[model samples]
Every structure is written in structure tokens, then in C-alpha cells.
Target chain A: MTLVESLSTGTGFWNPLAWLIAVLVAAVIVYLIRQRGESGYKKGTTQTVPFISGNPEPEKEMVHVRASNLYWGYLDALKGYYNFIVPAHTGVLNDYVLWYLGTTAALFVVVVFI
Target chain B: MFWNLPFIAVVALSLIGLATIVIKKNLIKIFLGITIFESAVNLFLISLGYRAGGIAPIFTSAPSTDMVLATPQALTLTSIVIGVATSALLLSFAVIIWKKYGTINTDEIRRLRE
Candidate 1:
């Protein structure tokens, strides 16, 4: 069979070529939109800072919030649902593995029983 | 048509994701790139199960399984839900970063420990 015939005859919905074309079109559109030129900045020549009459610059101090404190706030807001919350992301490899495994199992069950 | 949809979707998604990562400076936008890739993979998986004449897998007074493939639909749902969760978590991280640094640009968020 000719290549054209092969391409046209097997026009099933599950065609890989069609998927590829769709992906290509989407990607190209995104790229094109992103590449569009930005409008010129319209900033005034005067670069004077905003005046806070009489008020000082609040000590120019850096406020550092501890990770632990942040975690506490999040946990408190979540209440009991996500009790095992932590102060910082551990980036733990094991945790990721466990999460993926659990999700896979859940999906499997859902698909089978759905 | 059906068989090619996923392939095209994946390619398109990959391109979009890559463009997002390349062009966006905001941490949140970068995270969006990852999520875009995730969506593309999910679409590919769903496309994998597409059948020209398969019927929906619903049990209620439904048509025969002549034009539906239940596996892809179920998997797509699972992936979409997971995507939502991941997006929420990423957004939370973005918020925290904004609070800490008062900016979302990756270049400016260098104060925190790697």
C-alpha cells in the first residue's frame, strides 16, 4: 500500500501521528505567544522613591520567620486532617516512594472497581 | 484520529512546558511548567486506552462496550485530581516564598537554604 493510503486508511482515534500533531501544534502556539514582543516600559525619567512623610523606614530590618513557626501555623489551620505536617519539606526520598506507591495502588483499585 | 491524539497532546505539552520553563522567571510559573508536563503525560496515558468503537464502562442502562475504553477515563480522572493537589501544594510553597522574600522571582529567592 502507498504511504498516503496507509496514512489515510488507518484513521482511528488512537492514532499516534494525530497525537503528535496535536502536541506539536500546542507547543508551537505556546512558543509563539511567549516569543511575542513586550510593550516598551513607560517609566518616567524621574526615579524618585515614594515619600513616606515623617515615618521612618521601619528599621530596615529583615524579618526572619522560623520554619517551625510556619509549619505550626499551617498545621493549626489544617486541624486534624493533615496532622503529620512538618516545619520544612524534608525532600525525603522514601516519602516520595511511599506516596507514589499509595497513589498507584489507589488508582489500580479505583480502575478495577469503578 | 483517536490513536494519534495522545501522542500529539504529549508533544504539544512538552513544548509548552519547555517554553514556560525557559521564558518564565517567577517560581510559580516554573512550577506551572512541571504541571503542564504532568498533564501531557496523563493525556498520553488516556490516549493509550482509546478504542475506535469501545463503549463507556458505566454499568447503568448504558450502551455496549463497542466504542468505549474505561481504563483511560479512570486514569485521566486520577491524574487530574493528583494534578490539582500538586498544583495547590506548589501554590502554597509559592505563597510562603513570597512571604519570606517579598518577591517570586527565582533569581531573587536566593536567601533561603538550598
Candidate 2:
């Protein structure tokens, strides 16, 4: 029985074969959609180079992207939140201890209340 | 409530150690606090298996077979052995930190470094 073949956890059931078939079907649909993409796009050329006001693309290393730059947009959006947090990180030993103790106390409070 | 004295002591020692670790800036003091906390944990383990009028877990020709659980005692011994090694390692780290940084003050040590 297909239903009996599923792994059950009382409230939920999962069949790996069924999941694989669904994923395969979804992949086929995605492939069909990709076929309708822009016809002007070529396999490999300067046309594929990122738009930089029609200027020659620089080398990969010349880009000089920092690790922090990867999350620049996210950090910029959360500037207000970081402004409050950055100043609090004094790196003082006592402050670190207090933060840990405070967190532990919070956990204990949650355990007792919940 | 009379039988809960050891448990209460375990709680008190743990809290005191945690407070010491949090409030103290000195690395040596923090290590001492860690030792205190480890001792508290070991005591807690020993207390868990305690029983009145209990003899050693060894199979001796005793009148009654009332023996406390030996597993917790063994675990406490192992904890103590590990605690000794941890204290030694932590102290060495503190020594290295002091040698490299000139000052042992945690606040001063947080200065910008290349």
C-alpha cells in the first residue's frame, strides 16, 4: 500500500518516493519556463558582462569586494538597530559576563513561567 | 525539606560562582569562579545519589543491601579530573594573554590591534 509505505510520526506522514516525483515535476515546469527567456541573450560574450555604462568590464580581482560589502544593503537598512548594538559592545570582561548572566536568567524565567 | 539541604547548597554555590564569574574582571578570578562552579556541579551529582544508612556499592557481607547509586559518584570523580585539566589550560591562556598585552586589565586589553 502506498499510504502504508509512508513514515509516520502520529501527526505527520512522509513518503520519499512521492516527494521525489513532485520535485521532478516541478523541475520540468521550471525548465519549460526557462525556455521562454530573452532570445537576445548569448552563451558567452562581452554582452553577458555586467552593465557598467557600456565601459569595458574590469577583472574579477579588480572588483575588490569586502566581506562586509556582501551584506551592505541589509546592514544599511538595519543601521538604527546596529547603532544601538555597536556601542554596547564595549568588550569589557564584566559586561560580557553580565550579558551571559542576564541571558541565563531570562532562560530560567522562561522555563519557570512557561 | 530536611533532605533537600545538599540540593539547596548546590544551588547557592552555583549562583555564587556565576555571580563571581560575571562581576570579576580578573582572568584568575574568573578561573576560580569556574572551579567553584565545577565543584558545585560535582556536589550536585554526588547529592543526587545520596541515601540514608547507605553503604559502599561494593558487594560486602552487609546486613542490609541499601547502597547508594555508584554511577553519580564515578561521574563526579571524572568531572573533578577534567576540571583540573581545564583550570590548568585556562590559567596558561591567561598567562599568555598577560605576556602579549602588557596589562591584564580586561578594559585596557580591548584596545584596537592590527
lDDT of 1 by residue, B31-50 (tens): 88879888888878887886
> Cα deviation in Å at residue B69, candidate 1?
4.8
Off by over 4 Å in 2: A1-78, B60-66, B111-114
Clashes of each: 29, 0
Residues A1-114, candidate 1, lDDT per residue (tens digit)? 333232445554255666778899999999999889795556774334445685553544444665666778766778766544442233432344346657877999999999
* Model 1 stretches with alpha carbons more than 4 Å out: A1-114, B65-69, B112-114
Interface RMSD of each: 9.9, 3.6
lDDT of 1: 0.71
Clashing pairs in 2: none
